[model samples]
Target: MRTLVIGDIHGAYLPLMQALDRARISPLDTLIFLGDYVDGWSQSPEVIEYLINLRSSYNCIFLRGNHDDLCLNWLNTQQHNSLWLKNGGQSTIEAYKRITQPTLQHHQSFLETLPSYHLDSENRLFVHAGFTNLNGVNFEYFPEMLYWDRTLWEMAMALNPRMSPKDPAYPKRLLIYNEIFIGHTPTTRMGITIPMNAANVWNIDTGAAYKGPVTVMNVETKEFWQSDDAYTFYPNENGRN
Candidate 1:
């Protein structure tokens, strides 16, 4: 069975479905989704609902993202960071408001149940962001960092491009996992709009949150599928940034 890992969705329901279709996902496949399932677009509720159903038919692993945490905080405390509203949280708020109370609760409960990261039998690590100080073979100690650290990716980027993955100075975290997959840090911010690889880590967040494409990769084959530019489908709104 193929193993597919999706990038950050950011509430683009149609694009998420498109990427899934392009990837040719099957019932037998293992699907691991990087987070930020809400925010950016008007379909956050729909996206969550879709995932809820998807889990019943396939092996679905959903990881928590910073945006997901922000959504949860707003749901629990009835408050959120001001920047959250500006960064696509407004759309999520409006989407939930449009749904019935029980439906909203379903979404909130789903968000709360999401794990910070997932480790597979092959020892591949899948996270919304990356880990900072992970204990080898037992990586969940720094659970918060798994969903919030950018340094993990930054450290890999800091290495000289010429250095091998076996280089002595390689970040310990990257060396621990057979391979790592992450989202949260969109590739577009770096002026490129595609999945990027540094050492053994892969950044698949191709920036669907900011009008870029939604992408999914086949973890084993390293093949991937990408949706159309997200903005073209929703021409009337501006995504995050």
Candidate 2:
């Protein structure tokens, strides 16, 4: 069974569908989303609906992104915050306005239950963001570290200060993982990178909800499939906000 790892959707539903079609993903294939499923676009509600339905048709693993966390927090209290409103949360709110029951408790429950990070039997780790400590610690106690830690990601990439690939201090070796798949940070291009020899961390965020394309990568084959169209939620300089 092949595993397909997708980057942050960010409400770019059409491009996501197109990429999925291009990959020829089957119902039996394992599909893992790197989160940020909502925000940065006008179709957050539609994206959520599509994912909820897609779960029935495939082996899916959904991880919570920083944006998803904000949405759930806002939905529970109805109070707006900078993190929520500034980063496309306003668009998400607009998307929810079309629904008859905006506060869907069940949806919130699903989002809440989403794992912070996923590790396969082969020791491949998948997370929305990067972890600060590579000491084989549980991400639950350090959610922020997993969702927004750039230092740890850099250390893993540099592979420095550790003399040997087997050095326990090496971030990659600490996890005892073969590769790590992460999103949240947008890349100018769509492809894979082996940042470290031992770790092989791959970042797949292609900025679909921005001015770029959506991306999907086959874990085993390292083949990348991307949509042709450039999907964007933000308007032109003179367009409406």
Candidate 3:
């Protein structure tokens, strides 16, 4: 079975589905989602529902994202986060308004249970955002850090490419895993939308939350598929910032 790593969805249900269709994801393939399943265009609830149902067909590993934490805390803890609302929580709230309580609660439970990172048997690390330490640290301690650290990615990018693996300055995190996959930082921010490679890290977030395609990549081969621009799917709506 192949392993596919999907980047942030940000409620673009159509793009998400299109990416999956383009990738031809099957029941036997393992899907490792890098999170941000909600809060963007108009289909946050629909996106969550699709993922929930996917459990029956695929081996799915859903990592917790910062936006996901915002939504979950609002739902389960009844938080009134102004920052989250300003960022995209309002879109999520509106989407949930159309969903039933039972459905929202079920998805909430699943969200709360999601791990911050997943380490596969191949020693490949899957995380929504990178971590501070790669020494098998449990996310239960710094739950937020696991899903919100940019320094981890920056650290990888800052690695002296000239340094040998045995050098002391080499990132300790990369040594712990065969390869690391992350999505919190969108490659579009760098003025490009394709999956970008830096050192041994791969950034697959192609800005679907804003105006790029949702991406799905083959973990082993580094082959990838992308959807049409997510904004075109909802021509009348402006996705959240």
Candidate 4:
């Protein structure tokens, strides 16, 4: 079966559907979404609904992103920080409003149950943000590594003899996994960056919700696919648009 790893959607429903259509994804294939599924765009509700429906029809893996975590937190407490509200949480709130009580509860449960990181038998790891390694240490605790700390992961990727470190936040891991698929940072192009790395960590976040492409990569063959449309974020007069 072909395994397709998709980057952050961030509620860009049209582009996501376009990417899916272009890729010709099928039920037999496995689609692993790297999270940040909601927020950013105006169609947060539609995007969530589409993903929820897609799960029933195909083999799909959904991981929790930082934004997803914020949404869950707000749902439980009815309040959140400015970071959460500033980072497209308003759109998610609007999405939640359209749902009935039972459906809202179900969606909350789904978000809460999402794994922070997923590792396959082939040693490929999928995480939303990045990880931290302590002295050749491999963290089996997925949640902390997946969503919270990124210092060690950044250091490992940066200092490693492989790729030239672009961001100081990138970490280096001594025990390299076969492949690591990550999203969170937005890139202008859909193609793989840090290609010189021996560790095979691929950043597929093409910034679909912003001025960039929505990327998808075939894990086994290293084949890539992207959406045609480009998006950009513009701040309004009040610093929100």
Candidate 5:
């Protein structure tokens, strides 16, 4: 069975569906999702609902994202963080208005159960962001950093392409996992709209939360598929632009 890794969805459900159809996903394929499943568009509620149902028929591993955490907090506490609302939380809040109470509770339960990271038997690490510990994720001191930290990606990018892991200057964090997949930081920020590989880390968040498309990549072959720009899917809305 093929192992496919999907990038941050950010409530662009239509593009997500299109990307999946383009990829021709099979129920037997193992799908690893890097989170941020909500926020930034008009379909956050729909995205969560779809995912909850999709889990039953597929081998899916969902990781929690920073945005998902904020949404869960709001659902439980009924309070808002101004920064979150400004970023993409407002759109999620608006979409959730149409959802029934039981469905909302189910969404909340799903979010609550999501893991911060996943380590496959092949030693591939799938995390929404990155871990800080030199010893790796299991030793992480701050749990939230799993979905909030950018330092791991920054360190990977700073490594010299010619540098070997055996070299003294290599970052310890990169040495623990055979491969690391992350999605919190968009490749678009670096002036690209596709998956990026820096050292052993692969970033697949192709800016679906903003102007780019939803991306799905085969982890083994690196073959990928994308939909049209997510913003184009909702021309009337800005979508956290």
Candidate 6:
């Protein structure tokens, strides 16, 4: 069975569906989502509902994202923060208005249950943003770092290609996993719209919240598929731009 790692959706539901279809996903396959599934576009409610239903037939693992945590807080308390509202949360709030109360509760439950990270038997780690602990994720002192930190990716990006794992200066976080997969920060920031690899870490977020496409990659084969540009599907909206 193939393990497929999907990037952030950011409420571009149509693009997400297109990418999954292009990948020819099967019920037998495992789907690992890097989170930030809501916000940015007009389909936040739909995206959450679809993912909830998808679990019935597919082997799926969901990781929590910082935005997701913020969204859950809003769902539970109906409180809105200026920071979240300005950064795509307003769009999600608008989309959720159409959802029934029961469905909202279900979505809230789903968000609340999401884990911060997932470590597979093969020692591959999947997280939304990253973890900073020298001893690895389990030893991370700040739990929020799992979904909000960028240091891990930053370190990976700055790592010398020639650095050996045995080198004392090598990052212990990167050394803990056979491969690490993350989203949250867009590869588009690095001026690309595809998955990026630095050291052993793979970043799958291709900036679906803006101009890039939603990406789906097979962890083992490293073969990937992408949808059309996310903004193209929502031409009327300024999706997190």
TM-score of 4: 0.81
Ranking 1 against 6 by TM-score, winner: 6
TM-score of structure candidate 3: 0.95
lDDT of 2 by residue, 7-119 (tens): 88777777788889999999989999989888876767777878888899899999888889888988889989876687788877777877667446656767888888888
Q: lDDT tens string, model 3, 75-130?
A: 98787899888777888988888899899999999888888888889888888988
**Alpha carbon lDDT at 77, candidate 3:** 79
The reply for model 2, stretches above 4 Å from the true place, is: 137-140, 159-169, 172-175, 189-199, 229-241
Q: What is the lDDT of residue 201 in candidate 3?
A: 86
lDDT of 6 by residue, 128-217 (tens): 999988898999899999999999999999999999999998888888899999999999998999999999999999999999999999
Task: List ranges where model 4 is wrong by over 4 Å.
Answer: 135-142, 160-174, 189-199, 230-241
**lDDT (CA) per prediction:** 0.88, 0.73, 0.88, 0.70, 0.95, 0.95
Q: Report model 6's TM-score to 2 decimal places.
A: 0.99
- How far in Å is the alpha carbon of 167 misplaced in model 5? 0.6
Candidate 5, residues 32-146, lDDT tens digits: the string is 9999999998999888988998989999999999999999999999999999999999999999999999999999999999999999999999999999999999999999999
Pick by lDDT: 4 or 5, better one:
5
TM-score of each: 0.95, 0.84, 0.95, 0.81, 0.99, 0.99
TM-score of 5: 0.99
Extract clashing residue pairs from model 6. none
